[model samples]
Target: MAMAALTAATTTATAAHVHGLCSSSSGFNGRKLSVALPRVCAPATSKRKRAGGVAVAKYGEKSIYFDLEDISNTTGAWDLYGSDTPSPYNPLQSKFFETFAKPFTKRGLLLKFLLLAGGGGLVYAGSNATGDILPIVRGPQQPPVLGPREKL
Candidate 1:
């Protein structure tokens, strides 16, 4: 399992660049015209191809280019975005995915299992302790609040 996770995290990925140029017309025609930079590729969204990351761009009305690149630079995980807000990183899902993508050695598998079990146990224990410290099962009428407080 560990080997698999490692292998997966270290797989080849893809990246893309998105940018656009501008064109304008001038009036009165006196040293007038339009200027724009040569289309330079913008910062890209990169991720592993297996993770379902693809790049798509449209140039002319009838010409649209779409392809994937080799972008192994990204680790942990990544998601594609089409707007200003990038996608949130989902660690839990990515962990499961990375596990199968890579080949794992026996030792690696053992370590992974141990770590996951230990972490999960710790989290559960901590949650239980928290519950014990504050026995508040929030409900519609309960009006959950921290500490002891009478209704105002």
Candidate 2:
């Protein structure tokens, strides 16, 4: 009896909703279910104003205006970083490479040779240790047979 009343109320609510009317129906747990109707709203007006090619926007009581034509043209902009002039310090033009090259004097020659030889020895020792500890198989391996195969 309760189920029949609920079904009738749901049908009436659905019919009213289909005819563009807001209605309510009792849900399965006896809670009211509301149907929303479409509402008509007016279009919003722009708060911005234009004079010549410049656009002005108002924020609260303060108004700010900027020229649209000068936005893309950076000729009148200030040179903050001085990008037009050449920089005083350049990495490629500096004397940084001279330190790595062998000098005419024999000073520090032995130290440089010892450092290079020690680095190469350490790399070789690391490669051998890694290969021994983690032995990996390289190249194609034979696949395991799952079932008895017929003589082909």
Worst 10 residues of 2 by lDDT: 131-140
lDDT of each: 0.52, 0.60
Local accuracy of candidate 2 as per-residue lDDT tens digits, 1-152: 99998788777656656633433434346555565535668776675565567566663334534455565343445655457766587767556655655362466887788888999999999877743353244433555455556432
Please give the lDDT score at residue 140 for candidate 2.
30
Q: Cα deviation of 91 in candidate 1 (Å)?
A: 44
| Global CA lDDT computed for model 1 | 0.52
TM-score, model 2 to reference: 0.18
* Pairs in clash, predicted candidate 1: 3-103, 3-104, 4-102, 4-103, 4-104, 13-70, 13-71, 14-69, 14-71
Give the distance in Å from residue 35's predicted Cα in candidate 1 to where it truly belongs: 3.9
Q: Cα-based RMSD of the predictions, in order?
A: 29.3, 18.4
lDDT, candidate 1, at 126: 85
Residues 5-95, model 1: lDDT tens digits: 7564443111111222111223234332332324668676575356566786664345533323424332312554245664476878787
